[model samples]
Target: MARLRVFLHSRLVLSGLLAVTLLAGYLVFRYFYEVAGDFPFSQEMLLVFIGAIATVLITALLLIQQTDLELRKEGQVLLLDRKAQIYNALIDHIGEIVEKGRLDPAALADLRVLNHKLAMVASAEVIDRFSDVLARLDTAGHDVLVDEAERREIMRAVAVLTYWMRRDLLGRIDTEDEEAVLAAIKANNADLE
Candidate 1:
């Protein structure tokens, strides 16, 4: 936001600023020439040298800005990749539970460890949803969801959790978007029930 207010963001302001700078430089040269006696051959060459130095400085600044932008983009891509891997690990864990037809003590411990990994990359909302899933399993008397109603409820919870995970990975979904998601989930969960 602060960057958006810079002189470069406004072409007219930048042009006017450069024009003023050039005019001031010319006036200074005229003053020095008149006060000293002769005009600038030696000094004119000096001015040209200074101008070349200024051009080099400007080029370096531009290169630095470009490099900064590229590095920031790369960092974002790397973070996105990390987040995707963690999310995939979560889904894979669920697949393991489904295949085994039970969530044992070791499986629960693995889930807690996964939650720790999730904390490093997941949105706060996702972390909360996952914790809720853990809490639900904690209360179940059996190793698996043995009742149809309990199974359907767990499935709904998982679906809602997945929805939040998708939104988290994709980035930037506000409350209105959230309301829409919840509505869709509600409609679908009703069918499950």
Candidate 2:
């Protein structure tokens, strides 16, 4: 069944089948008109019928194409929603830690769970950037009060992660470094600090 669908979807196969069908149809019409000479319908009527069939086929093809596009768009929307939820959760969790200016055992555990969720949907760039957060936490050690310098580093790393997440959610291929975005975010966060 899958092979049949693949065969039907192949442009080369479809075009070849179309050529064969048209050839066979022409031969049948020729046989009826020339050999038997008992063509029931007038040539003008035959042309009209052919034109109507062509119109119907074209309409059906257009509808099928439109349906395929709609389905693709819907799938993208669903994926985008899922990604947004995951990204939001990650951001919120980090925000909570930053707000408290400290970490806890529970937050660390929650972060591990979020990591699994991120692994499922996050782009490589997002995952890589997010890992910096984990590394910073590890460097600071667990269940400790965050110092100003440590907090700034975390904010900068979160900014980088946020930048990558934005690109990933937008379906953009992110290859550039996030240093410039991180610097800007760091400067902004300095005022808030």
Candidate 3:
């Protein structure tokens, strides 16, 4: 299947097909001319030849354009799915830390790995925000203790970062939606500091 797709998309293949088509068209015209011997070529025959060429060209262009569009869409969906999985992993790590009220060594290591993956796929803004939060958490130390307030703050930051990452992955988020997400985050906890 893959090889067939490659062949279908190849410029060499297209050129070859076009050459065959033109050759076949010329052969048909030659056959008619021979059969008509001494009779001049009619305008109808010329029109038929022109029409066949136009049809072939138009069909080829449209097929190529459609195939390109479909391939691009598939690539985008795959990227979004990968980003979502990384975001979910980060969220799960945050949840674990919040529940335990302390960052375990294993959780810290997992968060670091997840953050690295996120960096690969996330937009600049998301990477900056997520990295900032992660840096702060790391500075606080692996066995760092967190009170209720601090834990909630950390959770809120992670939540907001996750939301932004998802919105960015899905495509543009309008100003209104951005404001709403910010408001929701603030409402959940005074601020996502």
lDDT for each residue of candidate 3 in 1-193, tens digit (9 for 90 to 100):
7744774667467767777777776776677677776666553575587578758876886787687778878989998899888877877877787778777788788887887898788898788779767765765445487677667657667767766776777677688987897778667665434
The 10 consecutive residues of candidate 3 with the worst lDDT sum are 134-143
The top-ranked prediction according to lDDT is 2
Ranking by TM-score: 2, 3, 1
In model 3, the runs with Cα more than 4 Å from the true position are 1-43, 189-193
Best by TM-score: 2
Q: How does residue 162 of candidate 2 score in lDDT?
A: 84
> Where does model 2 exceed 4 Å of error?
1-17, 35-40, 172-183
Which residue window of length 10 is worst by lDDT in model 2? 3-12
Better of 1 and 2 by lDDT: 2
Over 82-188, each residue of candidate 2 has an lDDT whose tens digit, in order, gives 99999999999988887788888898899999999999988898999999998997766554887778877887788778878887877655445445655667678
* lDDT, ranked from best to worst: 2, 3, 1
Estimate TM-scores for all models: 0.70, 0.76, 0.72
* lDDT on C-alpha atoms for all candidate structures: 0.71, 0.76, 0.74
Q: Write the per-residue lDDT of candidate 1 for residues 1-193, one digit (tens) a residue.
A: 5543452455445455556656666776667667755745856765785576557555655665676678679989999899899988986786566456577778778887888899999898888888776665555427454345555555666677888888887887698988898779768867756
